[model samples]
Target: MATTSTQRFGIFAALALVMAATRVHLSLFHHDIWDASWGVFFLAGFWLRGTGRWAFPLLMAEAVLVDYVVITRMGISFWDHYCVSAGYWFLVAAYGALWIGGSWLAKHQRGIKLSTLGMAVAALLVSENACYVISNGSFYWLSAHVPAPKSFAAWFENLGDWYLPFLETTAVYVGLGGVLHVLAVQLARLSQHSGQTQH
Candidate 1:
């Protein structure tokens, strides 16, 4: 149990680092890397499932801090930024959707199997879509950036425009995370087996 706790802490730290590193500059490796905030939240839920009471809020704070720094560095007031608005608060719910999806996947996972992979994919899709709806819908309907007299047709079209890019970017990170998770599990099993043999 101690080992599991340590491992979970390690994963949480790594995800937090990834989020800060990718988000702080808003561009990484000279614009080659997209933000990993979405992926980090999902992976956090999976790896740090039981720690959400503190872990989730900590990550959320880190996200806000990173944004504050990035926006300020650009000579823009954080509150005056185009993305900052009443709608912005809805991100809590948007990200919560991702965290819940990941937790659900962790609960349902029955080992590193085909079914597990399917579950992960399903969870990602459902969570990402829900997140998109909440975040995007809130922005479109509640933010001052969007002109008044909004229509469902325009909003739906807007959703279609950006949905794929967000999904694809998040998929890239989560897919990589999935591979690393499988490798870590396999390595742990091998180490355990080796220990048993020595005993």
Candidate 2:
């Protein structure tokens, strides 16, 4: 149990580090990397499911902090930033959808099999779409950044324009994460088998 707790903490720390490193790249001196914020949240949901009470809130706060720092660094007031609006709060829901999707996947996962892969892809598709909808919809409808006279057609068009890019970016990170997950699982199994053989 102690070892498990330590391992969980390590995973949490790693996720937090990834979030900081990727989410704040624009604010940092370099601007070469794409933001992995969405992937981090999904992976966190999968890896840190049991710790959501503290971990989820902590990650959310970290996201807000990153945004605040980035905006302030650009000479924009935190509250006055075009991204910061009532719609901004809806991000909590958007991210929650991702976290929940990850948690659901974790619950249903049954090891390294084609079925598991299918489930993972399904979960990612559902969660990512739901998240995109919440975040994009809120921003389009509620944020002042968009000019008035919002309409269903315009919103649908906007979704079509951005959805593919967001999905692709998230899929790239999540795919890497899936590879790492498979390696870890395989290594653990090999270690266990070796230990049994020695016994």
Candidate 3:
């Protein structure tokens, strides 16, 4: 619990590298699909730390690199790249990270309780939807500049474009990602327990 300066720096650096490398695949493969990659990022940055400021920049950096690399590989100039593409997702992730890191971690660290865990889980789910809605807001701005699809539906179309993929992907991504986080924490606790037993 008492993470030293070196430990904190090491954690941050390792996370950055892991996030950067995985993000490459996420950008290249899913490109348009928001799942598979980002769900893990949200969980890590959110649940792993309580510092909102640190989480925001690092997570955003990881996300940006994915997009930047992919767009460059495709030989597409991002000079006209929609700012919203970058900005809002960062907003969504940052928001979720802060919500989990600040609120959940703060409460849970105080004590282990079922109600606390349930509240944390509920917050995480709501945060996902909030991020989706925020991204759609980004789309709303992008749509104004880009060609709005000509149809009776405008906002609904934008909502569908992002929300559907978000929900479908989060279903798989969040569940798996949650398990990974839980396992990792359990492993850490196990190691600590074993060390204490040996002592």
Give the Cα lDDT of each candidate: 0.88, 0.87, 0.57
Global CA lDDT computed for model 1: 0.88
Q: Model 2 residue 198 lDDT? A: 100
Off by over 4 Å in 2: 1-3, 27-31
> In model 1, which residue pairs have backbone atoms overlapping below 3 Å?
none
30-63 in candidate 1: lDDT tens per residue?
5466889999888888878888898899999998
Error of 3 at 19 (Å): 3.5
Q: Between prediction 2 and prediction 3, which has the larger lDDT?
A: 2
Candidate 3: clashing pairs of residues: none
Q: Of the candidates shown, which would achieve the greatest lDDT relative to the real structure?
A: 1
Candidate 3 regions with alpha-carbon error over 4 angstroms: 1-14, 30-37, 82-106, 109-117, 144-153, 192-199
lDDT at 76, model 2: 83
Q: What is the TM-score of each candidate against the true structure?
A: 0.95, 0.94, 0.68
Task: Give a tens-digit lDDT track for model 2, residues 42-91.
Answer: 88888877778988999999999999999898898998988788889998
Q: Indicate whether candidate 1 or candidate 2 has the larger lDDT.
A: 1
